[model samples]
Structure formats: structure tokens, C-alpha cells
Target: KRSCTHRYCFAVCIKQDQRSRHARGTVPTSKERGVREEQIVKKIFATMVGSSSSWSTALVKISPYTFASIGIAISIGVSVLGAAWGIYITGSSLIGAAIKAPRITSKNLISVIFCEAVAIYGVIVAIILQTKLESVPSSRIYDPESLRAGYAIFASGIIVGFANLVCGLCVGIIGSSCALSDAQNSSLFVKILVIEIFGSALGLFGVIVGIIMSAQATWPSKG
Candidate 1:
């Protein structure tokens, strides 16, 4: 009877020990926690990177300046893409038109060049945004407060890029038609030029908005 009682007490003690270890999130020296443990952060790398305990908990410690930079890059990249695509459309039409009507070759070529200028606008905005974004020191950790500015900058870039992109595409289509129509009838040239100017104005709107948002943003700098 005493032996059976001793056995029951041992089982109970083992159960209690298991519960305690589970609560404390500790493992026995001989056992492993399996796959989940594999992705756990390494102590050495974490220590070398930064001292913030929040870094250990968070999956990504992205710097706000990184977002701002992405915005700046996007502004330039998307805008250029639009401008290039626009120029291609306009230039193709211009070449085809010139082949049919040599008289329009000099005058209609300016339309294509004008479309190419839209991309240059993107370059200007990107440079301005880059100037606004200050670099953080390597020794200092990113500030949480800067996230608002980062988001604002990012949104501004998107707005400018897509706005310019659409504007450029619209202008390209109109310019292509204008080039073709102008070749057929020189009288249509002035009217189409007016439409192209209006199309170019769309990009200016994006620039204005971007400038406003970028002005409000201030990148964090190391003290």
C-alpha cells in the first residue's frame, strides 16, 4: 500500500513540475521546443544591432527615413516611366506623320519633346523630396515619432507618381492623335497643342500637392 502511495505522489509531483515549467516558458535541458524555436532571434545579433527591448519584440524595426526615401525614389521612377511611355507614343506618331506630310516634321516634333518634359518634372520633385529627407546617424536608433512623416512622404510620392503617370499617358494619347491629325490638316495643330498643355498641367497638380506634404515632413537627424 505504501509503495502504491509513493508512486502516486511521484506522479503528482511530476505533473506539478510540468505545469510550473510551462508557466515559466522554460524547457528541460534535454528537450527542444521544435520548429518555432528555430526562428527565434539570436542574442548576439540582437545585442550588436541595438539596445532597445522593443526591437526584440517587433518583427521589423524599419527606419522612417527608409520610407521617405522609397517615396522619393517612387516619385522619380514612376514619373519617368510615364514620361518615357508618353514620349514613345508621341514620337511614334510623329515619325509616322512626318513620313506622310514632311511639312509637319519640324512643328509636330515639339509636341514629343513637350511630353518628355513631364519626366523631368518627376526628377525635380524627387530631388526636392530627397532634400527634405535627412539621414539618421548609424549609432542612433530610429524614432517612432518619425513614422508620421514617413507615411506622409510615402503617400505624397504615390500621389505624385500615379498622378504624373496618368497625366503623361493621357497627354501621350492626345499628342499622338494630335500629331496624326496635324499632319493631315495643319489647321488642327494649334487646337491640339492647347489640349496637350492642359494634359501637362495634370502633372503640375501632383507637384503642388507633393510639395505641400513634403514641406510638412521633417526627417529625424542624429543629435
Candidate 2:
């Protein structure tokens, strides 16, 4: 009976040890599980708040085609405006001066026609610019290279337009004065023609620069 009691007590001790081990293991496992759950919640909340990637991507997204079209229009339209004003200013003066001096009709007509030629120059430049430009693809907005190209072309158009505008107006004024002076004193026609030539030369400056600037402005695809 004493031997039996010793065996039974040993069995009870063994069972208690197993139960304690299970309880200790369960506690650590439960703690690990709670930590994992907290981490998951944090990640979910962060995602729900706006992330940097979407905003950054949108920042670069702009319409390159819109700017390019505007550039083309500016190139043509501004040139036309300058030319029309030049022609009107010179033509009206020529007509008035011709009435006062019938003998100077040929000289005054030449001055007015020279002013009109400014319009022709603008048309020619506009055609060249338009030809150089390629149509923008509808599928894409602004890519890096295309955006750079658009900016370059836009600058070219603006520079050319403003330069031509100023030169055309200056030349027109000079031409009108030339017509009147030539009517009053035919000897002054040659000297005034020189000034008008200089004014016309100013417009050519923009055309040369624009051609150079637009030379590399091909529609960018890869970047």
C-alpha cells in the first residue's frame, strides 16, 4: 500500500507540471497574437488616411497638348494681329499723303506695300512653325520629355510673337512717316527707307530664334 501511494503521488506531480507548461505557453501566444492584431490596425488606418504617392503622381499630371495648341495659335494669331495693324497704319497714311502730292504716288505706294509685306512674313513664319509641330496623342498627358518640349515650343511661340509684334508696329510707323516725308521732299525717301529697313530687320530676329528653338521640339514619347 505504501508503494502504491508513492506511485500515485508521482503521477499527480507529473500531471500538474504538464498543465502548468500549457498555461505558460498559452499566455505568451496570446500576447503575440494581440501585438500582431495592433500592427494590422495601424497599417489599415495609415492606408485610410491619404498617402503621398497619389498626390505626388497627380502633381506631375498636366495637359501637354493644351499648351502646345496654344503655342501654335499664338504663333499664327499674334503675327496676324501685328501685320494687320501695320498695314492699316501705313495704308491710311499713304492714301492721305498721295492725295496731297499726286507726283509721289509711286513712292508712297511702295512704302504701304512694304508694310503689307510684314503680314506675309508673319504668315510664312506661322506656316513653318505649324509644320514643325506634331499632333499630341490623346492617350497620354504630360510625360517628362514631352513636358520639356512643350515648354520650349511655348517659349518659342511667345518670343516670336512679341518680337514680330513690336517690329511690325515700329516698321509701320516708319513706313507711314516715310510716305509723308517722301511726298514733302522726295530726297528724304532714301534716308527714311534705310530706317524702315532696320525696323523690318528686327522682326527677322524673332523668326531666326524661333526656328532654332523649335528645331528640337519633337513630341516626346518615352519620358
Candidate 3:
């Protein structure tokens, strides 16, 4: 009887120890869950930090000077593209007219030279517009704070750049055609001298437009 009672007491002690261990394990698991919840809350707060900021409000805060500068730049691009396409149309028509005419003459040469100059004027306008935009301070330019103003400036630049590009193409074609005519008609020696001047004018126009377009395109809008 004594031995049987001793064995029973030992088994009861072991069961009690196991129960205590299980109870302790439950506490650690609960602590771990709490720790995970804390981490998740921290992450959520970090993610939502920027959600309350007003983008439109920031856009409204943009400066008027910045808007004007960028708008002008874009306008220059549009102007260039417009002039280019226009010149191309006019020049192509002129070429067709020249082909149907009796023959290449001094009168035709003079007309062609003047017609080509119109495209050069377009380039000149683009250059002036671009230079104006470039002179503006970087701080005045658009950034995230001035989203509306910034985008507007960028749009203007794009318009002017494209317009200038088209204008250049038109001038080139017209100038080439004029020179070829002068070359084919050897009798117009005096007119050949004028061709050089016209060609130089085209070259100058191209250079000015190119410089302005580059400046407008490189200027940053958003940060």
C-alpha cells in the first residue's frame, strides 16, 4: 500500500508541472500577438502620413510668374510646330507652281526668296520667346508645390518646340528648292549672289530656333 501511494503521488506531481508549463506558454503567445499588432499599427500610420496633404491646394499656391514663363515656353513650341507645318504646305505649293511655270527666272527667284523668309520669321519669334523663358530664375519654376503652374509651363514649352521644328523643316525644303533653281538657270548670275544671303538667313533662323528649343525642353517642371 505504501509503494502504490508513492507512485500515485509522483504521477500527480508530473501532471501539475505539465499544466503549469501549458499555462505559461499561453502568456508568451498572447504577448507575441500583442507585439505583432503594435508593429502593424506603426506601419499603417507611416503609410497614411501623406494622405491628408492637399495636392490641389499646393497647386493653387504656385506663383504667377512661374506660370507665365512656362506658358510662354510652351507657346513657343506650338508656334514653331505651326509655322513648320504651314511652311511645308506653302512651300510644297510653291514648288508645284514653279514646276508648271514657263521657266526659272529672276522674278520667280525673288518671289521664292521672299516666301522662304516668312519661315525664318517664325523661327525668330520662337527664339525670342524661348530666350524670355530661359531668363527666369529656377526658383520661380514649377515644382510639386506648384503643380498647376508647373504643368502649364511645361505644356507651353512643348507647343512652341514642336512648332519651331515644323517651321525649320519647311524653311529647309523651300531654301533647297530655291538654290536648285538658281543653280539650274546659269543666266541669273546676279541672283546666285542673293541665294547665298537667303541660305545664310535660313541657317541663322535654324540656329536660333534650335537653341531656344533646347533650353525650353531641358527646363524641369515637376520635382
**RMSD in Å for all candidates:** 12.4, 21.5, 19.7
Model 3 Cα lDDT, one tens digit per residue, 62-177: 66456656556555545545455545544565466557553544444554454344445545554554454433356744544344334434554454445445545554455445
Candidate 2 lDDT, tens digit per residue, 145-217? 6776676677777777777788778888888898888888999999999888888888788878877887767
Displacement of residue 204 (Cα, Å) in model 3 is 20
Error of 3 at 60 (Å): 3.0
**In each prediction, how many residue pairs overlap at the backbone (N, C-alpha, C within less than 3 A)?**
0, 0, 19
Better of 1 and 3 by TM-score: 1
lDDT of each: 0.78, 0.72, 0.50
Error of 3 at 195 (Å): 25
Q: Where is the poorest 10-residue window by lDDT in model 1?
A: 35-44
Work out the TM-score per prediction.
0.69, 0.67, 0.30
**Stretches of model 1 off by over 4 angstroms after superposition:** 1-60, 137-142, 220-223
Candidate 1 local lDDT, residue 58:
61
Pull out the clashing pairs in model 1. none
Best-to-worst ranking by TM-score: 1, 2, 3
